[model samples]
Target: MTGHVVWHGRRVAFRRGESLASALMAAGVHNLGQAATGQARGVFCGIGQCQNCLVRVGDRLTEACLLICEDGLIADPDAGGRDG
Candidate 1:
């Protein structure tokens, strides 16, 4: 089956070799979360060199830009945690 992932209780469809950040952007999810002091943040760097596009995959923090879209992957854009 084609790759897919969930975001904040919404099932998002993705394709093979697609990045989580790209999937999110395609789904119109631009604002990922806040930074140190609850500041708005998103994909600053398309690569994995930045922490702007961090998201909560289950309970662990992952870089959306670097994480490949996988089937049944659960992600919380507003997890209310550090990465959220």
Candidate 2:
């Protein structure tokens, strides 16, 4: 099954049970965060152990790889003006 999700104010398509990070990457969104040295970051570890693939879901910080893609799921890649 598939669902509609929004990322960075843009609509994206995702399949059920899929991670938001995968959906974002499939949509050509690899730059999920910026490093202090101005480096782009995405998924380093597919599991939730790593905090590299962090994104904002509402007001909470969550790991994109651990978050299941769902309909109407809203996420901000650069939330809190981090890495931007």
Candidate 3:
């Protein structure tokens, strides 16, 4: 099944079983957030090993590469407090 998730307040479509990182990247959202040194961060390991893809899902910080895309899922890049 296909559905949409809220990314930075915008709706991004994704298929069931797809990771949040994959879906966001497919939707042209490459820059997930900023690093502590003001460098842009994105998917690196694609297996949740790297902390580059961290984003705030609701109130908790998680790796987007490991997070499955679900309907109505909300991801806020700025909420992770990594925006430098």
> Could you estimate the TM-score for every candidate?
0.85, 0.85, 0.90
Residue 70 Cα positional deviation in candidate 2, in Å, after optimal superposition? 0.9
lDDT of 1 by residue, 26-75 (tens): 98989887776777779998998978898887767889999999899998
Where is the poorest 10-residue window by lDDT in model 1?
75-84
Best-performing candidate as measured by lDDT: 3
Off by over 4 Å in 3: 79-84
| Winner by lDDT between candidate 3 and candidate 1 | 3
For model 2, state the Cα shift of residue 43 in Å. Answer: 0.5
lDDT of 2: 0.83
lDDT of 3: 0.88
lDDT by residue (1-84, candidate 3, tens digit) is: 499999999999999899999999999999998877777889999998988999888668899999999899999784237442
State the displacement of the C-alpha of residue 24, model 2, in Å, after optimal TM-score superposition. Answer: 0.8
Report RMSD (Å) for each prediction in the order shown. 2.3, 2.1, 2.0
